[model samples]
Target: MAVVEIYDTTLRDGSQGEGISFSAEDKVKIALKLDKMGFHYVEGGWPGSNPKDMAFFQRIKNHRLSHARIAAFGSTRKPGVPVQEDGNIQCILAAGVSVATIFGKSWDLHVTRALGTTLEENLAMIEESVGYLKSRGLTVIYDAEHFFDGFKANAEYALATLKAAVRGGADRLVLCDTNGGSLPEEIAAIIRRVRDDVPVVLGIHCHNDGELAVANTLAAVRAGATHVQGTINGYGERCGNANLCSVIPNLTLKYGHETIPRSSLAQLTDLSRYVSELANLHPNPHQPFVGSSAFAHKGGVHVSAILKDPRTYEHIDPALVGNRRRVLVSELSGLSNLFYKLKELNFNLDASREETRRFLEEIKELEHQGYMFEGAEGSFELLLRRAYDNYREPFKLESLRVIIELKENSPVYSEAIIKLTVGDQVVHTAAEGNGPVNALDNALRKALEVFYPDIRRMQLTDYKVRVLDEKDGTGAVVRVLIETGDGERSWGTVGVSTNIIEASWQALVDSIAYGLLKNNGR
Candidate 1:
């Protein structure tokens, strides 16, 4: 089997993205996870840039990594500075990481404009910095920054810079598409030219400005590149880096290369979602392999075909990437789609000709009235069960009141009182929270806890609000979607009302009801 090394720069380049920053603890945790996932190299940030990165080097020393060798990133020696006297070079050596990667100018334009130095001087900087790092016994990876653009503009100078690094004993030469504007064919052509001319192991680092980073990377691998650099969820500056979530699965399943252990491939979905949460960024549902909607079938015809044979609609088995096939029900859903989804909920309703029409009509009517069943499966299941069988209510709401007050010098306070009846007992509870919706959620949970203790375990994970008509301004009817989790799985519920608080409260009630129903029934 061919060995294509996976180099993760999420902790370094990924953090360079706008609205993205990781704490020292976040970096350590992510580094450990990458090591667990068996990446060949994990690049921590430049230690000299910030205290957080410096602290990461000290903090990571406490635990031993299993697979990944941590690498420290830095730039080449300055124009007038000696390798030994340069602050950046000294910091790279001081970093406790096992490997060192230094980026140098490969583009003559950047060399002239950014560095304001002669082309020959840049070559000397690359050679001295790489040689000094290699002399320190650190595995050196020389990143030929903007190699693709430089190769297009002046192929001779770019090749000269790489030759300088090789003369300095750099182990690997990484060609970077820093501008991310190179097409796959252009990348393949340039890399092939470099391979025929240069005699070093090649790697590729791409940006997605052209939306072709993944394609260009695959082209690089196909053109004899042995190492690939990317981030977990493709998180990086500008348009982001090549997505490893897509790259790993494509390599293992499509190209038949074992970049990581085959068994570890199943953890890809979890790893992508985990990093997104830590970064406090909402996961992209449409991302290739690990996204929520990657394997989800929504069209009525597609859902029906998938129900008969998933291969009819799917390209590859979703289970191979730790993703499941989902059939979503909506106005576009046919009767088969509804039946298929009901089966997932463990409900076997008799879908006779007449009954199917009745259920479909009701679903279509609800969808026409601002209800979306695509994300709210719990609500769909409850509605499905009710249509087929005698549905039982776990609790009944009697009354509710919410109060909000703005203090002169203090923060606003929101309070709620809820009265509910469970079996023969009526429970009343009052609670205070940061907002009116939160207060209602607190009071409802408190009242329900007396009857169903498991309600305490359910938490609202996400809340999305959408206004139906912006022309109405404050009087606009808003829809609230609340996602609830029980430490294991998640379900969504939705409500619509002119008052945002009322809509939130309705969704909150449905969330608790669905949670209690599922737990008690189980």
Candidate 2:
């Protein structure tokens, strides 16, 4: 199998994105994860730019990496400065890594306007900076920033910049789509021309401003580039960088390139989410391969076809990327969706049964009334069980009351009182909370915990309320969705009502009931 190198810059380039900030410890953690997954290179950060990056270098030295070579990233020597005396160049050498990646101006516009230097001096900076790092026993990767744009404007000057890096003994020549405006064909054509002039190994780096970074990178690879640069979730400045989460699968599964170990490919989804968590960003559910909704089927026709063979609606087996196929039940769902879900839950409800047909109709009616089960699988399961002949109620609600009080110079007070029967026992409880719904949740859980102690393990993670009709004004019906988790697993439940408190109570009760059902091994 032919191999292509995978270089990750999430700790460096990705952190430049808005709302993304990683501590030195976070960088170390991500680097180790990349190493474990067999990435060829991990760019630590610019040591000369910040103390956090310097701290990263000092901390990473304590642990030995298995697969990835940690590369220190920096720019070329400043114009009119000696490479050896340059502060950025000195930091690259002091990073103690075997690999160093330095970028220099390739476009003439940037040469004069961005760098404020003569074209000849820019070439000398690229050569001397790469040469200095090479002489220091570092494998130098020279990035020709804005190479695609430069080639389009002045092809000869761009090729000249690459040749300069060659003369400097640079190990790899990376052409960057820094502006990310180049098309795939443009990338392919430029790389083909550059390959004829530059005799070094080639790599491709791309931004996502044009939303074609991954496409442009693939074009460069087909045009003879052997290395690919990107971040895990495409996190970067401006729009973002090329997402390696998409690139890796496209390379290995679609193009047949050997990149990461095929066995380790299953870790891709987990790795993407782990990085997003550390970055304090919500995972994009619609993102290509690693997203939660990547393989989810919703339409009745699609679900019916998917039941026979997943390939009917899916491009590839989701498990190949550490994800699974999901059959979502909604107003658009058919009997097939219910069947698939029931099979997953170890139920044998016949599709032709009258009760099954009525159950499906009931779900449709609920959805028509603003109760969407697409994101509320926990509530769907409870409804399905209720239709079975052997089903039994876990607990019964008798009455509930909530109170709110306001006093001058004092914070508003909210409390809830609940009465419920568990088997033959009646338990009543009262609790105070930040709000009426929270107090209701607290009081109900407090009442149920005596009978089901495992309920203590469950906690509400998210609560979202959507108004069904904005034109209905203050009397509009609302839908409440609650996400609950039991440390290891999480599920969503939903309720719809004209009263917000009543809607919240229904979803909250279903959440606890479903949690108890799972804990009881039912």
Model 2 misplaced regions, further than 4 Å: 450-453
lDDT of 2 by residue, 68-96 (tens): 99999999999999988999999988889
TM-scores for all candidates: the values are: 0.96, 0.95
What lDDT does the true structure give each of the candidates?
Answer: 0.89, 0.93
Off by over 4 Å in 1: 405-413
Model 2, TM vs. native: 0.95
Pairs that clash in candidate 2: none
* C-alpha-based local distance difference test score of model 2: 0.93
Candidate 1 residue lDDT tens string, 116-147: 99999999999999999998899999999999
Clash count for each candidate, listed in order shown = 0, 0
